[model samples]
Target: MCGRFALFTPIPQLTNKVGAVMSERDIGPRYNVAPGTWIASIRQASEDSAPTLEEMWWGFRPSWAKGKGTQPINARVETVATNNFFKSAFAKHRCLVLADGWYEWIKNTSPKQPHYLCRQDREPLYFAAIYAKREDGRLGCAILTEPARGSSIDVHDRMPLILNDDSLESWLAPDLTDKETIRNLVGHIDADLIEHWPVSTAVNKPSEGQGDELINPL
Candidate 1:
């Protein structure tokens, strides 16, 4: 699960790459984004319009849940289409959770080492996510995760459903609502295009080590 991530890219560069207009001009760099915090996401207002960048809560809480239970930060891809909690959102409220890189733990080690993973070229990572309107009328989102593949399996058994530039349009196409079609858009991410390395474990605590140095190779 993508419990933590970083989005240090400037708002202008990020908007340019994703083809989104920024909702706010001053979205500062976030080096250690955690669940429950507001994060940037891309979504279309309608099928014919361009997508826009907006800030949304990280965890997803269904409207009927009334904020009384545990809100999940990640949804399993295997059951997302059928799960009662996520099905409706998966069908119509799909979104792109923006990030530059994500953190994963190597559990096989004595003290699980945290690793930062990102595209080889350092482009922003657009994670497949579904959002829901909360009881309080606020929007919340959850990242989609699938079984790990290739080298990523060594760090964790599951990884966020990342989308490439080619797949971005299809995944964000507002008119596409068929479950099977949506699932098919989640094509294989070339593992070779990804890079990872151990980082300081200071990221383990969400409130501390939020600087760029936290993601530096250890």
Candidate 2:
């Protein structure tokens, strides 16, 4: 699951690359982003226009969410198509969560290592995500997770559903009525797009903002 990630690209550069209009001008560097914080995401507001990149809360709590809690950070790809909390958003509110890389914890005899995972070619990785607007008008996005691919699986059971430029069209433009089409797009992340390496575990805590400590090797 994509519990942590980073986006250091300037908002204008990201807007052009993702074919999105910038919603804010000051969305600067985020090297140690965590869940439950505002993030950058791209979603088409209407059929005719390009996508919009805006700051979104990194948790999804649809109107149907019960009781008193914030929301969920990541949605399991295995059951999102049918799960009560995510199905509707999966069909209708899919988005591309923009990230330069993500940090995953690896178990070891020593201290748990934070592995930074990203595209091998040094491009931003867009994770297949779903979003929903809450009663108070907060937009939330949740990264989808599937069985690991590439070398990262040795460290974790699940990895973010990452998309390259090839699959970007299908992922960002899905037929809401066609479940099969959506499922196909969801499952076909290119394994060749990713690479991983160990780093410091300063990212274990969310309170720490973007800092060199998070990316520095121990």
Candidate 3:
């Protein structure tokens, strides 16, 4: 699962690429974007219009969930259609979470190695996500996870749903709410389009003193 990622793109560049209409809010650069934090996303409010950019809190906890707090950072693609917490959002509140890169742990014989996977051409990665509104008025989003294929399997079993320019409309269109369509859209698994390398574990302690030195080759 993609628990950590980076999103430090310039506001203008992001708006230009995705054509997202962003609010006046600016959160600045973030190297380690953890769950329970707000992240940028392009979401379509209805099935008839173009997508709009919005800031979404990166977790979901259905109000019916009997607890003080039960946050969700991801929604299993297989079960999202039927799960109460994600079903409604799956049908209509789809979104694309923007990221420059994402991190995954590769457990080899030596130790757990963390690989920072980014686009080979250094382009941005757009992840398929679903979101809904909370009673408090904040938007909640969750990343969709699917089994990895080919080279990515060597590192992790599952990867976030990635959408390129061509696949953006199908994933974001609220009208195409068919389960099989979503399954077929699992994409060709473009792991080769990604660049990966090992990094120091300093990223583990997010609050301490992690900085650019953390992404350096270990």
Candidate 4:
């Protein structure tokens, strides 16, 4: 599950990369984004308009949930399309959750080392996500996760569904609603494209510190 992530790329750079207009609200760099926090996401302004950046709460709560329970931060790709809690959003509210990198822990080892993972080229990463509008008129989103593939499995058994450049158009196309086609578009990024290294445990304390030093190689 993608419990924590970082998006320190300057706002201009990120908006340019995704062909989105930056929102009026200034969302400065975040080096330790946690669940329930407002995070950056890209979605269509309308069915026929260009994509735009928006900030959404990280946990998902469907309208039917009635604010009664915990909202999930991650949804399994294998079951997302069929699960009642996520199916409706998965089919119609797909979104792109922006990030520069994410953190995962190697649980099999002592002390569970935390590793920062990102594209070797340092380009921004986009995770497949689905959003829902609650009765209160608030937006919430959840990242999609799949069983680990390639080198990422060495650190954890699950990883976010990172989209490649070629798939972005289809994934974000507002008019596309075929479930089978959407499912087919879900693809795994080759693990070799990413690089990782152990980082300071300071990242574990989100309230205390969150800066470049958190991702620095230890």
Candidate 5:
């Protein structure tokens, strides 16, 4: 699960790369972004709408599920399309979550060892996501995750469903709602492009980090 991550890239540069119009200009670089917070994403208001940079609450609870117990931060890709909780959003509210990298902890270690994973070239990673209006009518999102593949499995059993750059526009294409079609059209980024390293355990406490040192090699 992608519980913690970072997005320190400047908003202008991110928007330019995403081809999205800047809608929320005041978002600053965040070096230790946590769950249950407002995070930035590129999404279209409608099928024909141009993508726009907007903020969405990181936790997801569909408006219909108000008063229900769960607000999950990550949705498993295997079930998202068929699960009632996420299917509607999966088909209509798909989005791309921008980030420089993400944090994961090695499983079963005496003292959990946190690692920072990012593209080898340091280019931004775009996570496949879906959003929905919550009980309070606020927009919230959940990152999609798949069984860990490549070296990422060494750290955790699951990782965010990151998309290849070529599939970005197709993933967000509102007209392509058929589950089979979506599955066929989108593909993940090359796992070889992802690299990870041990990082200072200061990241163990979410509130205690928001600086470059949090991600630096231990």
Candidate 6:
């Protein structure tokens, strides 16, 4: 699961990559982004609107289910389509969770090792996500995760569902809500393009460090 990640890439580069416009709030770069906090995302508000950069609370709990269920941070891709709590958003509110890389732990180690995984080319990475407005009116989201692939399997049994560059626009298109059609048109970034390396354990405490040094090779 994508419990912690980073999104220090400049907003201009993020917008240019996704053909989106900037949002009103200023989101200063942060190297240690934790759940329950607002994070950047790219989404289309409606069929007539272009995609825009916006901030969404990392945890998801639909307004309708308020006070009834858990606010999940990660939604498994295999069941998100059929899950009662997530299916509505999965069908109409898909978005991209922007990041430079994410952190995962090797649970077998004495002090579980943290690894930073990102595209080999260091380009912007976008994780597939679905969002819903909370009772307070703020948008919240959950990153989609799938069985680990490639080098990611070395660190954890699951990883975020990253969308390939070619699939970005199609994934956000408001009109293409059919689950089967979406699965066919939107594909993940090749697992082979993902690379990871052991990083400083500082990432284990999301509140302890906010520097790039946390991602430095150990």
Best lDDT goes to which candidate? 6
Q: Which digits, one per residue and each the tens of the lDDT, describe model 4 over residues 44-129?
A: 74577888899999999987898888899999998998999999887788889999999998787667678998888898988999
Estimate the Cα RMSD of every predicted model relative to the unseen true structure.
1.6, 2.2, 2.5, 1.5, 1.2, 1.0
What ranking emerges by TM-score with the best candidate at the front? 6, 5, 4, 1, 2, 3
Candidate 1: stretches off by over 4 Å? 108-111
**Clash number for candidate 5:** 0
Residue-by-residue lDDT tens digits, candidate 3, 1-218: 88988777776576666566766787577777888878988887776566787888888764455435677898887788899778888877788898887888877534556777777788888898988776577788899988875456767888887876777777777777877777576453376886677787756656744355655667
- What lDDT, from 0 to 1, does candidate 3 have? 0.76
State the weakest 10-residue window (summed lDDT) of model 6. Answer: 62-71
Model 5 Cα shift for residue 181 (angstroms): 0.8
* Candidate-wise lDDT, in order: 0.86, 0.77, 0.76, 0.86, 0.88, 0.91
Instruction: Write candidate 6's Cα lDDT for 148-167 as tens digits.
Output: 99999989999999999889
TM-score for predicted model 2 compared with the true structure: 0.88
| Over 4 Å off, model 6 | none
> Which tens-of-lDDT digit does each residue in 1-218 have in candidate 2?
77888887666665676677878557777888887678888887556778888778888887656435768898988899899778888877888888788888886635666888877787677788888887667788889888988777867889988865666656667354366777665455568777787776667766765775566555
User: Where in model 5 is the C-alpha error above 4 Å?
Assistant: none
lDDT tens per residue, model 1, 131-212 = 9888888799999998887677878989898887777777778888899987777564677777889998788887886899
TM-score of each predicted structure versus truth? 0.93, 0.88, 0.86, 0.94, 0.96, 0.97
Q: How accurate is candidate 4 locally (lDDT)?
A: 0.86
Per-residue lDDT over 94-139 for candidate 5, one digit per residue giving the tens place of the 0 to 100 score: 9989899999998887578899988889988889999998888879
Compared with the true structure, the alpha-carbon lDDT of candidate 1 equals 0.86
As a whole number from 0 to 100, the lDDT of residue 1 in candidate 5 is 89
